[model samples]
Every structure is written in C-alpha cells, then in structure tokens.
Target: MSLDLGRTASPGSTPRAPGRLGVPVTAAEALRYLTDLGLWIDARRSQLSAIDQAALNAPDQGDREALTHDLTVSMALWKAIADRYELLKVAFDSGRVGPTQAEQISTLIWGRLDVTPGQAGEAARSRVPSTADGALAVSLPEACRLSDAMTSSLRARLALEPTAMDVGLRVKSIREGIERIRDQIGLIPPGASRDKANHDLVGLEQRLFGVTERAKRGADVGGYLGPLEVDVAGRERDLIVAAARRVSGERDAATARAKVADLAARGDAIRSLQAQCLRDVTPAPKLGVPDVRALGAVPTDADAVDAFLRRLELVSRALDQAHETYARALAEREELRGLLGALDAQAATSPAITEDERADLAPLHTQLVATLASTPVPLVRARALMAAYQSYLQAVTTNVRGPR
Candidate 1:
C-alpha cells in the first residue's frame, strides 16, 4: 500500500516563481504557472484541514477559539484565490482563448480576487469601497501571501511542525535534564567548583520555572525555553565531565592501594628467604631488600596515586633481584652437598679400591662431611674440599687397576 506522490514538476522544466504579484509575459508561461499554483493550492487546503482538526481538539478554550477564528479567515481567503485560479485554468484549457484573452486572464492572478460577504461587508463598512459585487481588490498573490503568513503563525502556536515538541513534553524534558545535572553535581567534591556549579544550576531552575509559567498562560515561551535548554545542556555536560574525572581518580587510588598490599606481602616473603640463605650459604650475594612499608599508605589524590604506583614498581623489581640472589645461593649449597655424598658412596662401594685405599680416603671424607654440616657453610671452601676428595679416590682406583 505504498504511494508515490510523483514529482512536483516535469524534468528539465525551470521552477516557476512563487505566488508573485506579477503576471507572466507569455501565455505558455502563464498556463504553466497556473498549473503549479493549482497544485500548491490543493496542498495548502490539506494542510489547513489538518490544522482545523487540531484546533477543534485543543484542550484550552481560548486557544481553540483563537485558532479556529484565524483558520476560518485563512480558509475563506484561500477559497477566493482557488476559485479565481480554477476559472482561469478552465478558460485557458479550452483552447479558445488567444494571447489577448490569456493576457486578460493572467491579470486575475496578479489582480484582486473575490471576498466572502463578511469580508466585503467589513470593507464596505470601513468606507474603502474596495469590493465590487463580492470581490476585494487584493491581488491573488497578496491573498496567498497573507494566508501563508497566518498558516505559519498557527503552526508555531500549535506546535504543529515536525520538529516542534509539545509544551508539556518539552517542560518534562527540561525537568529531567535538571535532575541529571543535580545527580552529577552530587558527585563533585565539596569545593569552590561544586559551589559554583550549584549556583549555575539554581539559575537554570529559575529560568525553567519562568518558562513553565509563561507556557501555562498560553504565551509563546519558545524564545525563552530554547536558551534555557541550551544552558542546561551545556551545564550538564560540564558536570558530567567533572564526575567522570572524580570516579577515575577514585578507581586509580583503589588500584594503588591493592598494589601496596601485594608489594608489602612480597617484601616479607623475600626477607624470610634471605634469612634462610644466610643460615645455609656463605659468601652469598649481599643484596638489600627494600622495606615496602616505608612507602606508607596510598594517597587519595590522582597525581599522588600515580607517583605511589611508580614507587611500587621499583620496589617490586628490587624484591625480584633479591629473591633470585638468595634462592640461587641455597640451590648451589644443596647441589654441592648432593655431589659430595654421591662421590663418597661410589668410592666406598667400588671393588677397584683395596682396603688400604679405604683407610686413605676415610679422613678426607670425614673432613668434607664436617664442612657441609656446619651452619652458614663456607661455600668456596666446601667446593674445594669436595674436589680434592674426588681426585684422591680416583687416584686410588687407578693404582688398584694398575695399567688400564
């Protein structure tokens, strides 16, 4: 059920002038202009009909009466123009009117049109004598112009344009905007900035109240309402930006606090490992572990939080280096102990070693065992002694085998 309204004019045809108070110089132009004018009249009639219905349904008594009176006058004026246009169109379409007659008909468009008795009587009573029979001396174009002006005013008054919101809807929207701004204002910390924002909001609320009052009285408050809406919108935007910054700052602070706790726990674990390493391994790397508690609690300010996070990163790196140093020292100590024990077992079990070699190896093995068993063992000395013990056992084996 779709309908194409068709194009306004034929392709390649120049647009006709709007309802001007001047006649076309040629008959063809005049006929074309008349056809376009008739189409315009039809469209205007439909628009007026819709407006008439809206006026009848208006809730306000004063608005309905005022709108209905204006619509009546406008429709009457439109009828006079349409009737004249119809007469000229028929005459021209008959194919009998010559250039001279067409010129005469063109005068009807640029000349006065007929008026209703009410208009004629008013004109007559006013002593203007502008009407002959029932026709007024106002040109058709002038009549159309008057009707157009009235129609525009009516549309604006009724909020009939597509982009024009109803008064109640606009008021509600502004109120909602105010509430949103209020909520954002609450997010602002108590400071000079928040106070200033509150001041601006108060002003906007006052302006809104004035606009609402005018609207209730049926006054055209559009001029007042528009600027208030812009101010409210602009203020809301500023408050929203401020609120977002505050939330971001709080989030960063929370994250920094969590990081502080994590780094503190890690520092304690690294210290414990360092103590163990000191007890078991001599000549350990003397790296100092940083005390994360010295950095203190995370700050509330955004800039301070950033600085605190950087400090945490440095502390974390320090802990990593210290942990690696201490853990590696412990690992080396355990590795040497395992190696020394394995070599001693091999020598005691080997059949290549005679009883005399066993007596030779026993004292050196006892000294190596005492060195490993000592707390905070001297790693460098332990390694040297283990190497000597292995060499002595290997020599004893070679002697037992003779020339292998």
Candidate 2:
C-alpha cells in the first residue's frame, strides 16, 4: 500500500521496541513486509509522481479541489511507506531483527498515522488494512521472500533486473539434510572414512551458510543458490555413501571393541573371584582358569572375536561355580575347626575328668581333626563333625553339673 509523505511524525514519537508494539514479529516478517512495500511503491511510482506534480503546479483557487486533496494524501502516504521501507531494509541487511528494531518497525508502519493535516478526513477516506495483526503473523522466511521480490522489482525499475531466487528455502532444505546425515553419522562409530565424510560435509555447510549471508546482504544470489544446492545434494549423497561403507566396519568393530572391553573386565573379576576361592579352599586348589591374560589379544575378524568372547563367558561361569563351592566348604571347615578348639580347651582344663568323659570327647576330637586335615574339606562331612563335637561338649557339661 502507498504511504502518505505529507503526514508529519508525532512530536513525541520516540522509537520503541517491537514487543511494545503488541505484535509478534520475526526477522523474516520484517524483511517480507519491507520487500513487498518497496515493490508496491515502485509499481505506483509514476502514477504517484504525476499526482504530486499536478497538485504542486495547480493554482490555489482553481487547483481542482478533489484532485488536489487526493494528490496531497497520495504523496503523504507514498512518503510514509517509503520511510518504513528504508527502516526495514536497514534491519534486513543486518540479518537480524532484535526485539527493539522490530518494535520500531511495527510502530513506524502501524503506530503512526497522522500523515494528513485532517486525521478525521484521512481516516474516512483511507482503506489501508490495519497492520495490527499482520506484523506479528509474518514469519522470517516469508519476510525474506517478500524482501527478495521487492529487491527484484526495484532493480527492474532501473533496468538492472536480477533473476529471482529462493535461496532461503534451498539453504533450509540443505541444512535439514545435513542434520539428518549428522544423526546417521552418530549411529556409525568414528573412523578414518567417517571422519573424511564429516570433514567434507562440514565444508559444505560453511559454504551454504555463506550463501545465506550473501543473500541477506542484498546480493543477487540466484546463480549462487543453484551451485550451492547441487553441492549440498552431492555432499549429502557422498556422506550417505561414505557412512554406508564405513557403518558396517565401524559398527562391527565398535561392537567387538565393546565386547572385548566387557570381556576384559569380566576376566579380571573372574580371576579375583577365583583367587578368593583358592584362598578359601583347604589346600588352595589350582584354579584351572585358562590364563586370562591370553584373551587380551583380540582377533581382527568379527566371528573370531565373537567366538573368543563366548569362551570367556564359559570360563567366567565355571569360575563362578567354583567360587560358590569353595566358599561353602570353607565356611563349614571353619565351623569344624572352632568345635575342635573348644574340645581341646576343655580336655586341657579338666585333667581330673572321668574315663567316660575322655572316651566320648576322644571320638569327637578325632572326627574334627580328620575333617580339618582333609584337603578341600567337604561341606557335608564338616557339618557332621561339628554336630558330634557339640553333643559331646553338652554331655560333659551336664555330667559335671549333676548332684555329684
């Protein structure tokens, strides 16, 4: 829409932030509005210029009152629109429209409306759409498209026209593709081939970012976009191809490496547990656990590595069982030893004890000694020895406490 150039800005009208304008706006929206406005003004430049000249030239008395008033309003409106366009253009070129600039823009476009001397009259005659809701609704990409079109139209007005380009959309699509490729790369473990692919993709992203920056600076990016898009597509294809080749090797190797690390940890744990078991056993039986150090050498082949892992698993399970068996038998043996110690103490303390007491205690003490002397003492035999020893001690105590 045309702006009113004759309308004087409000006396106290200081620039305000876009947030203060009570409208939501993104960088794209500002760009679009500015671009569209510029093109619109350029389109009506001749018509507007003629109306302005005629009003200026016409006599005050015979100035065709209707034409005079129309020309005045049109000139005022065109100027206002142009001023807004310049404000937005500067903001757009910066590639960023922070809240404050955005607010200034919205206020300039929709907040100030006193373009004509007679506000009431202008309001009655004007049919311009209220920008209250419009500014906040426009998005950044939409803003870019609008701005790009305006740039093209302005250039055309001077016969220096440039081809239109949708650089924003291309850049956006390429970026999305890059992100997807990155996610795929995450699934594949790091390696030489993947690193090379990643390096190439990174370079491509930088080039695309540059293209976007050039577009923001009002460069004719139409030619640049095509080559960049092709490069992005090709790079994306190469990345996928690269990932495909390396993924199997990297993933398998990664998985194998993980298995090897796990096996190593498990082997250390099994060895520790095996040592514990040997210590618990009566004679510390030789743990037949194949040397854990031998498994440290991982094979390069996937199947061979997998087989080695299986062997480790089997060894771990056997060692675990050995630990349990030895620990149980050890607990029993310790209990039997305690009983033997009690019997020997009682025998030594009571030299005057009767023959019957000695006979009963002798058999119990013999059983305890036999059980303790046995290598890798069996849990069942040790339990029986402890029971017998307890019975003998209880009988002797009862006899000593009898009426005699």
Worst 10 residues of 2 by lDDT: 128-137
In the predicted model 1, the residue pairs found to clash are: none
For residues 1-404, write the lDDT of model 2, one tens digit per residue.
23333433321111222333457566766655554554555654554454445546556654345445444444544555555567666655554667776666666554533233233244323322112121111222222222222222222222232244355755676676567557655755567756876787788778877888987999976666655555554444344333333433344456656765765576566667666656555455555544445666656543455465566667557656656655555565676677678767876777556788788778767867876776656556667777777776766665645455
Per-model TM-score on C-alpha atoms: 0.46, 0.34
Output the TM-score of candidate 2. 0.34
lDDT of 1 by residue, 1-404 (tens): 11123525331111243344444335556556666776677767877887898899899997787677667766777788778877776656544557665666667666546565364234222321122233334456545644554565565566565656687876776787788678778878898988998999899899999998888899998777666655665466445434434544576678878878888899999999999998788887899999888988878765576677788889989999999999999998888889987897888688898788788788888988999899888999888888888898888767645464
Off by over 4 Å in 2: 1-321, 346-353, 374-382, 399-402
lDDT of 1 at 242: 47
